[model samples]
Target: MDVSQRLSFFAALFKVHENPTTGMWLLYITIVLLSILVFKLGFAKKLPIIKSAVIYTFLILGCTVLTFLGVFLPVAEGLVVAALILIIYKIRLHQEKKEQAKAE
Candidate 1:
């Protein structure tokens, strides 16, 4: 099969067209959460503007590509879930560090 055919095949495989509304919402939520996370992380490191710019540029590029491929929503949902997990892990680590510091 040709490129278009291959792409469609994969998009169908991922069920991108199954629920457009849900997918759009997922993409929206993913973008919002990612922006917040990036901003917070960047500011925490004292490079808010530069860091958020760099990270968001890549993220938007990736999202655009996925949108074109018709799998943007599913991918965005996965990313959001992963980011939340990472945030939770980071918070736990920070708490543990604080406890250790207090004990010492």
Candidate 2:
């Protein structure tokens, strides 16, 4: 192949993925991490897990409602929301134990 053709072939091989689904999934994960960071920084005095969970759930639910209003796909929104809920639940459980310890 000519140099132009060879260069084009290599360029195609290095091209970024254009899959909207995959990109959306990645965006969801990034948002989750950002939410976690926000909770960590904002509620450092609280139980780590509890703060994380509350922030995560709130953000996820907000995102889900937005998606329902035709912002994104249901599947993507569901997965992200589920993740957020799970994180919040874990944190809440941990906080309960810590509070009990304080009481005792």
Candidate 3:
């Protein structure tokens, strides 16, 4: 299918066209929240509030642009899913390392 058709397919999957702005906002929020979750669980325990705000703002903008361009729907979803899975795996590995240290 063409780009518009592919985008429409994803939009239909998520009912995005019913309320475009709301759909965009929801997608932005989802990306920000997932990114924060991954960062907190696998990388840093704390982020400066300003730094966090800036990062999320840029993320939302970037994702929104990509979404509007009709290129982000499928690929971004897959990337987010993969990132979440990686975050989970990293957390499990860290916990195992801690347990090993305790045993040792």
Candidate 4:
């Protein structure tokens, strides 16, 4: 890639300038999995099996677009940070609830 294209951290890391197919696939999978993790940790709610299936379907489809941007941006990195924050929040919330229950 040219100097400008290499500005994408993951693109350079994945050697996209050398191998486009492999790099693109790696970026796509990374983005999709991270997107699902972020969704489950921060936004998902209980639903019927079919409803959940539909939601996942759309989520997977949505990740396709994200994959393109991910190659040129920190999309996966951002999602990772978001997922970590949500996970920490959930852990703290759980602990608070446990402490309250014991006090009660």
lDDT of 4 at 18: 81
* Regions of candidate 1 where Cα sits further than 4 Å from its true position: 1-55, 70-73
- Over the stretch 1-104, how does candidate 4's per-residue lDDT look in tens digits? 46546446776777766888998888888888888999999889999999999999999999999878877788878988898999999999999999999999
lDDT of prediction 1:
0.57
Candidate 3 Cα errors over 4 Å, as ranges: 1-5, 8-10, 39-47, 69-72
Measured by TM-score, the strongest candidate is 4
Which 10 consecutive positions of candidate 3 have the poorest summed lDDT?
A: 1-10
User: Which portions of model 2 show Cα errors greater than 4 Å?
Assistant: 1-17, 47-55, 63-104
User: For residues 57-86, could you state the per-residue lDDT of candidate 3 as single tens digits?
Assistant: 776667666566443356446547767787
lDDT of 1 by residue, 7-100 (tens): 3433444444566666545554455566457545434455578875886677666655555544422544444566777788789999999999
Clash number for every model?
0, 3, 0, 0
Error of 2 at 92 (Å): 29
Please write out the lDDT profile of model 2 over residues 1-104, one tens digit for every residue: 44323222212232213454554455545445554554454454555887757866787766544433322223344444666776787789899999999999
Shift of residue 64 alpha carbon in model 4, Å: 0.6
Worst 10 residues of 2 by lDDT: 7-16
Could you tell me which 10 consecutive residues in candidate 4 have the lowest summed lDDT? 1-10
TM-score of candidate 4 against the unseen true structure: 0.88
